[model samples]
Target chain A: MTSGYKDLSITVEFRGGAELLFEKKKNELNLPGDEEWTLRRLLFWIRDNLLKDRPELFLLGDTVRPGILVLVNDEDWELLGQGEYKLKPRDTVLFISTLHGG
Target chain B: MCSVNDAEFETDDELMQPDEVPQTEGAICKKCNENNAEVVLRVKDTYCSTCFLAASTHKFRATIGKSKLVRPTDSILIGHSGKAGSTVLLHLIKAGMSEAVHKRLMYKTTVLYVDDGAVLGQTVDQRKSTISAIREQVHGLGFTGYAVSLNESLHSSEPKIYPLDEEAEDLKGDSDVVDLFNAVSSYTSKEELLHKLRQKLLISVARSLGCCKVFTADGATDLAITILSNIALGRGAQLPLDVGFVDSRELDIKILRPMRDFTRKELIYYLNFHKLETIQTPGLTTKKEPYTSIQKLTEKFVTELNTEFSGTVSAIFRTGEKLSIGNLEASNLIETCALCRAQLDTVFTNTSSLQATEFSKLISAEGPKGNIGKAAFELKKFPCVIDAAENVPLRDSKNCDNCSCSKGKEKFEMSAKNFEKYLCYGCRLIFKDLDKQHSIPDFLQNSVRQRISLDDMREEIADFLL
Candidate 1:
C-alpha cells in the first residue's frame, strides 16, 4: 500500500478578523519544508515563504477528534483518519480557531 | 333580523346594567399574592422592592469584603462598559480589603463617575439612561456621581465633517473657520471629541486629587484597541497598558483593572449571580451613540471575536505577553526632533498611531542590498526598544478615524471622488462608484463589497483597521 501526501493548502481564521492562508507540500507524514518547524511557521509564512515552515503533520491510521482542530475541505480531518486515512495530493488543510462563544 | 337585534339588545342591556360593587377583592398582585407587591422580585420568591434591596445588601457586603471604602473619602471612577469590570473588581477589592476576614468592619466607600460624553452616547436621553442605571445600582450604596465633558463641543461652532449635510455653510466662510474647521475635523470625530473631553477630566482629577491609583475598567478587549490615536496629536501609544500608566506616573497614582481574565458572558453571569448588575445598561443610549462609531465597532469586534474564537484571544494575549510583542512605544527621552522637538509621541509621532512604528526598517524599497533582510528581521523581531527618534510609520494606513489606519489627510471632507482615487488599489475598487444609500464600515469591506453585496451598511462605513 502506498502512503504519502503533497500539495496541501492551510488556512487559519483569526478570531479578531482576517483569514490567513498558507500552502505546502508533504513527504510521507512530514512536511517537506523547513518552516514545518512550529505550527505557527505555516501561518507567519503563508504570504511570504512556504518552504520555511510548510508544515508536515502525521496521523495514526485511526484516531478521533485529534484535538488539534484541523479541517480538510471544511470537514474535520479526524473523521477521515479511521481507515484508508491519508490526504490526497491536491487536498487543502485548514486550522481554525475553536469558537465556542455565543 | 329585527327580532334578533331586539332580543340581543335587551340581553346586552341587562348584562351591562351596573352591578352594585361587591365587597372589594383587594387590588392585590396575583404573582406576589399581596396587594402591595406592585414591584416584586419574581426570581427570588417575589419579594417587594424593599426586601430585594435588603437581600442584595448582604451580597454587596459579602462581595465587597475588603474595599475598606470609607465614606466620602476615596473617589472611585466608573466607565460604563469598562466600569462594569471595575465595579466587579471594586467589589472583589472591597472583599480583599475587608477586616471581615478578621471579624470587623474595615472600610466605607465613595464612588466617582466620569462620563466620557461618548459621542456614540450623545443626547440627554441616552445619558440619562446610562446615568440612571449606574445610579439605581448604587442607590443608597453611598456613591458620588461626577459627570464631565457631559455635552461640551470642543468648538464653539460646528466643523466640517462626515455625513456632510450640516457643514456646507461652514465651508463658505472667510474666517480661519475653514482651516480651523478642517483641523478640528482632522483631529476629532464624534467619538474622539467626546473621549478627549472625558480624558482631560480624568487627567485633571489625577493631578488635582493626588490620586493613589485611578482605576479605569480597561480589559483585554481594550488592550487590543488602537493605542495610538491620530486625533490625539500624534500621542503614539496613548492608552498604555497598566504598566504604561505606571511608566507615565511619577506620583503615587495607579490605574488598575481587576477583571481582565473573564469574557463578557462570564462578567454578566458574575454580576447576575451576585445581584450586582451595573446600573448602566446598554442599548438605551443608541440614539446619541449610534452603531456606526469606532467604540461600537470595537465592542462588536471583541464580541464577535469572543463568539468566533473564544479562548484563542486570551491565549494570544498570553502569547504576546510572553513574546513581549505588544504595542510598546520606543521613545528617545534625550533625542530631539531635528525640525520640531515637543517630545515625539513616537519616533514618528507626527503621523497617526495606526502607522506601524517599526516600519522604517522593513522597507522592501530598493535601498542597500542587506537592508531588506534587516527590515524583515525588524518586522519579525520582538517589539523593539530602539532610538525613539528614528521610528518609521506604516504608509498603508490612510484614514485616521479607525485605529488600524494611518492618519492621512481628512479624505471624507474632500471630494468623494478624490478620496476614492487616493485609496489603496485594493481598497480603491471598494469605494468606486460609491452608493449614497449604503453606509460602509471600512476599506476592507468596501473592497469586499465591490466583489459582492455585504450586509446593508457595510458598503459606506468602515471600522478603521486598528
Candidate 2:
C-alpha cells in the first residue's frame, strides 16, 4: 500500500458543536492519492471544500484549533503522529470540540 | 573548542520538540496488557474499550463513594444541560444503578433541564424543540425529567414545572428575561446574571422536588476555568464552595460535582466508547468570540494551555482543592448575600480594600459645589448628616399623617443603594450593572425586606434587660 499512490477513501466526523462550523456531522470523501497524503494535507483540503463558515473556529495555522481533539479511528491522534500521520484507506477521523459549555 | 567563549554555541533543539508519539499499531492495553488498545489518553496512556469503560466507571463511582455524602434513600436531581459531560454522567449513573444484586446504587435519580433559550434569543418554536429533544434523551434513560423556563425567575409565585413527556404552554409574550438581558450593560455582566439566575432556579426546583442533593457535571477543566474567572470577578471569598465537590451555599440543599475528576476529553472518549450521542446546546457565548466575556476568555486560555501542557488543568484544580473555608467560625452565623446566597463579604477592617474603594469614590465623585476640599470634609461627616436627614423625613411623615409620605410607614421599598448593602462585594458589582434594582427576582427582594424588618425590630429592643 505504501509503494505507489492510489485513491483513498475516508470518513470524517464532527461532534460537540464542532459540526456547527462544518454544517454537517459527518463526511465521506475520496482523496486522490497522487502523493502520500498526511493529516496536515487533509485538513487544508477539508477547509477548502467542506468547511462552511468560521474557518478560524476549526483551523489554527497548520493544525486543527487547540481546543479541538482529533482522533484517528477512535484513537487519539497524539498517539499516532498528530498531523504528520500518513493517511491510509478507510481511515476514520473524528474532530470533537471541547470549547462548548457543559 | 579552543575556549568556552570561542566555541560555537550549540543548543539541543530536540528538547523543545513535542513529545514523541507512541506506536499504536499492535499495542496492548496498558491496564489489562492482553486486549488490543484502541484509545489513547493523556498523551501516551493507552487502553482497550473494556478497560477504558471499566476505569471510567470506577472513577465515577469512587468519586461519589469516597465522599460518603449520599444516603441510600436520598434523592439526587441531575442538572442535565444536554451536553457531553452531563450525558456521560447520566450514563454512568444508569450503569451503576443497574448493576447486579448488592452493587446497585439505591439512591433515586431525577433529571432537570432549565431552558435558557430566552436569554440566547431563541424563538418559542426553537425552545420547544430543544425541550423535546432533552425530554427524549432524559426519558430514554428511564429517569423522571422536568423542564422549566428561566424567565420564571421574574414571577412572584413559584415557577411552573412541566413533566418532560407532557407539553408545556408557551409563556405569553412575556419578554421579562429578554428585557433583563437587554438592560445589562456588558456581555460579562449578562453572563454573570444568567449564571446566578440559573443557580437560584436550580436550588428552588431541587427543594420543591424534595431532593437533598443536586448533581452537576462540571469537569476538571470547567472547574479550573471557574476558579480563575470567579477570582477575576471578585468572588475570591466564595471560591472554595463554588469549585468544591459539595456546594452547601443553600444551607439545606447541597450541589455536588461527581464528574469533577474527569476532563472534557475523557468524557468524550467515554461517550464514544459506549456509542452514546450527546445533544449540542447553545450557551450565552456559543457563537461569540472567546474574548467576549471573562468566563469565555478564561475557558479559552485554560483549554489552550492544557493542549500545550497537559497538566495545566489538573495543577489548577489541585490548587483549588487546597482552598477551604471550614475554619471560619462566623461562616454559619454571618448574614449571606441577597443575590447569590454566599456569605456576605461586605464587612471589612478599617484599613481594607472596601473602605479604600469607598474613600476613592467619595473623593472622585462630582462634589456638591464642585470643590474637592468641601467634598472631602462633607464625606468625613456625611454619615451623621445623612442619618439626621433621613430621620427628619420620618419624623415629618409621622406628624403629617395626611401627606403621601406617610405611605412609607406601611411598606418598605428597597432602593438600589439600600439593596446593594445586603449584597457581597461581587454581587454589588452585578447589582450596579443592572438598569433597575427592581428587576431582581422577587424572592431576593422579599428576603432583603424581611431581613431589614428583623434588623429594625432588634434595634427597637436594644435597651432591654440582658
Per DockQ, the best of the predicted structures is 2
How far is B259's C-alpha from truth in model 1 (Å)?
A: 2.3
Local distance difference test scores for all models? 0.35, 0.81
CAPRI docking class of candidate 1: incorrect
What is the C-alpha local distance difference test score of candidate 2? 0.81
> Model 1 over residues B52-135: C-alpha lDDT tens digits?
334444444442233432332454443333234656655554554546544443333334454432333344455545555555
How do the residues B1-466 of candidate 2 rate in per-residue lDDT, one tens digit apiece? Answer: 5555523445666234544555665567899999878777776788988999999998988899889998878999889888889989998888888867347787888889988888888888888888888888887766778888888766656777788888867655448888888888777888888888888888888888898999999999889999999999988889988899999898899999999999888998898888888878667787788888999999989987777677789999999999886444554457889888988876655566766777678777766556777766666555456556654444343333533343544455555666676888888887777787336666777777666656555656768938
Scored against the true structure, residue B10 in model 2 reaches a CA lDDT of: 58
RMSD of each: 28.2, 4.8
What would the per-residue lDDT of candidate 1 be over residues A27-86, giving only the tens digit for each residue?
Answer: 123344322223333333343443232122111122211112444443333233312334
Instruction: Compute the lDDT of residue B242 as modeled in candidate 2.
Output: 88
